[model samples]
Target: MKIAFYGSSLLSSYWNGAATYYRGILGELARHGHEITFYEPDAFDRQQHRDIDPPDWCRSVVYPATEEAMRSVLAEAGAADIVVKANGVGVFDRELLEGVIAQARPGALKIFWDVDAAATLDEMRADPAHPVRAALPDLDMVLTYGGGPPVVDAYRAFGAKLCEPVYNALDPATHHPVAPDAAFTADLAFLGNRLPDREARVEEFFLRPAASLPERRFLIGGNGWDSKPMPGNVRHLGHVYTHQHNAFNCTPLAVLNVARDSMANVGFSPATRVFEAAGAAACLITDAWEGIEQFLTPDTEVLVARDGQDVADHLAALTPERARAIGQAALARVKAQHTYALRGVQVDALLRAQMKGANA
Candidate 1:
């Protein structure tokens, strides 16, 4: 099948979390004999900070940050078997949503892939005229990164004909454990782009734990954190690139997963970090969230924490051997059920089913 995807930067993860997710799933789809064209805006710092060259499996089209440029790109995308307008494209999302739907051929699948479903839903509920909500009925399907029953039901209630989650999963080729890098070594580490919605949680789950254990080394990676103040023991490495994720995860004695408020409330949503950290075979201590166990078994494959005290206690309790055992179990779980190859097959089946239903 020929697929056209419009999303945040595909060549840079600078401020985009969807880069790895796009790379993993789309790359695997290519391996399964699907042709893909990914359209990304040349905006923000992504173009300047690009960390990856265009993949052989994709035609990575970069257009100028203008309405005319996007319209031209969408015109081209409209002819594919599937045309996707993903969340957080970083510019003119409302226009793109309308353009993709308008230009898509009648037989082509016009999809709105919401990488941040919880947040997207909130926006629609807050304002009925939000482009996604307006486009819901016309969309062939709505795909989400996270959200299981509740998310699907919400989309249905909002008038979507179909909704499915293509959850984040491991790309072994990209995220498997690598030798630890000295620069990233720490007792605990977290890699997340600092966003307003997650900063308070980061403080509660990460900063407070650091304060509680002054002697332990804690590392924080990702951009937008350099301006924040931190405890003396915490190391802030601004903007860790995609190539560095494996080493970053491996170097930490244990990594932490703190979900943003929206994702936490949505339950079943697991961020890409969950799979990445697990793929690195790193012991993971995550903040409590509903439906977490469905992804990774708590107290066995992962450790769950309700507060800073819980985080500190878990860190103190895990001996190296115990931590290693947990990491291995988590890694095994992701490898078995959550690799991108598996996800690609699932996506292909869904698309085929949708196509069959369309014909019938």
Candidate 2:
């Protein structure tokens, strides 16, 4: 099938959480022999901050975020079998949806891909400025990257034609375990940007642990975390790149998972790091989220940490051999079930069904 993505910058993940999801999904779709045309608005310097070039399997279409440019792009997209207008693309994304749904030729499927459904819904619900408030009811389908059972039902209740949740999956081919580095390696490490709601959780669950473990080394990496005060044992490495994620995961004795407010509330959804860290054979110590057991078996596959004491227990209480065993188990799970290739199969089947319905 020929698919067109009207979404955020495929290349720049610098501060964008959806970067890995786009790369993984598109890369996997390409591997499955589908033609994908990724359309990104020229707004937001998305092209200039390109993190990855077109991987030889797909086409990249850059268009201005203006109405004129979008109308032309939507015409081209009219020829595609499927066109996706993902949330957070820019102001033009609102128009992208309208143009495709309005001008799309017969048999074309339009998808509202919400990479951050929890966040999007929160913004849309709280403020009048969210552009899609009126337009959302007409969407043919709504897809989310990471949200459990509740999110799908919620989207449907809000008048979506169809709702699906695409959980974050690992690309084992790209994110397998690697050798640990002494410099980057630490007893505990976390990789996430600073956000207001998440900062307090980070402080209680991650940094306080570092403070308590004065003798143990802890590392934190991500943008906006550089200015924050840290214990002497905690080292801040601002903004690790996508390519460098494996190294960051591999080197940690136990990688930390901190969810944003939305993720914590909507459970069973782990981010790229959970799978990436496990794929790298690193033991995981994460803040407790209600649905964690579905993804990782706590105490055996991952450690559930709620506070400084919990982090210390995971870091110090577990024997090195036991930690290794747990990490290995986590790795086995990702290898068996959580690769992006697995996700491709799910998405392809859904697209086929949706396409069939559209044609019928």
Candidate 3:
């Protein structure tokens, strides 16, 4: 099957958080003999800050941020077996959706892959006439990054015919345990773009923890944080590249996973960092989110922090041996059941079922 993915920059992680998810899932799909065409916009400085070249397995199409360019790109996307217009494409998302669904082959599956379903659902809930709500009934499928049952149910409530979670998973081929790097050496570290929805959580879970443990060294990697009033004990490494993630994860004694407000409220939503940290065999301490146990068992596979105090306590209580043990257990769990190979199988089943229904 040929899949057309229209999302954020595939060659850069600069401010595109979904880059890792796209690389893992689409690469696996390609490896399984499916063709993929990734269409990303040439905006957001992603081209200037690219960390990777286009992969050979899939065709990478970078179009300009203009209606004329998008019209042509959407036409090309429509030819595929499945056309996905993912959230946060950093372009004219509503316009692209209207164009893609209008132009796609009658037999082709037109999907809205909500890499951030929490925000999407919230928008639709607040405004019934939101563009996504209007598009839901026409879409063949609505796939989410996470939010489990609540997310699926919410989409259905908004007139979605089919909703499912295509959650983030570890890509052992891309992320794994690596030798620690001196530059990123820290007691606790976090890597995420500082978006409004997530900044409060980051402060509560990460910055507060660092403030409480003033003696401990902390590292923050990602853009939009350099200008913030960060703790003196915390080091901010602006815009860490995708290729350097393993080293970033490995160098920290324990890595932090701070959920955005929407994701945390929705529960069961694990960001890409959760899997990447586990894949790299780093001791993971995350802010409390419901349904997290379904992915990684709390207190065993991962440490759960309810607040800054919990984070401080977890950091203080963690010994080298215990941290190593947790990292190992987390790694074992993800590699066994949460790899992209497993996700590819799920996607294949979905495509087959959709194709069958189309034929019917």
Q: By lDDT, who's the top model here?
A: 1
Comparing 1 with 3 on lDDT, the higher-scoring candidate is: 1
**Alpha carbon lDDT of each predicted model:** 0.92, 0.81, 0.90
Q: Give model 3's TM-score versus the native structure.
A: 0.98
TM for every model, in the order presented, reads 0.98, 0.93, 0.98
Residue 81, candidate 3: alpha-carbon lDDT: 87
Stretches of candidate 1 exceeding 4 Å from the true structure: none
lDDT of 2 by residue, 1-360 (tens): 898888877877766778788888888888887899888777755566667887688788877778888788888877788878888876666677777677666777878898878887787778666655565665678889878778877777667788888888788877877777776878888999898968988998888888887989899998888788889989998878777888888877778999888888877668888988888888888888888887888888899987778888778886778778998999998888888888889888888888888788
Total clashes for model 2:
1
TM-score of 2: 0.93
Candidate 3 residues 1-360, lDDT tens each? 888888887888888888888888888888878899999889988999998899999999999988899888988866788888998887898888887788888888999989999988888878877889888777999989999999999889888889999889999988999999999999999999999999998998999989999999999999999899988999999999888999999888999999999999999899999999999999999999899988999999999999988999999989989999999999999999899999988988888798899879
Tens digits of per-residue lDDT, candidate 1, 59-164, equal: 9999999989988898986679898999999899989999998988888888999999999999989997888888988899999998999999999999999999
Off by over 4 Å in 2: 42-49, 64-72, 127-130
Cα-lDDT of candidate 1: 0.92
Instruction: Give the range where candidate 1 is weakest over 10 consecutive residues by summed lDDT.
Output: 351-360
User: Which of 1 and 2 is ahead in lDDT?
Assistant: 1
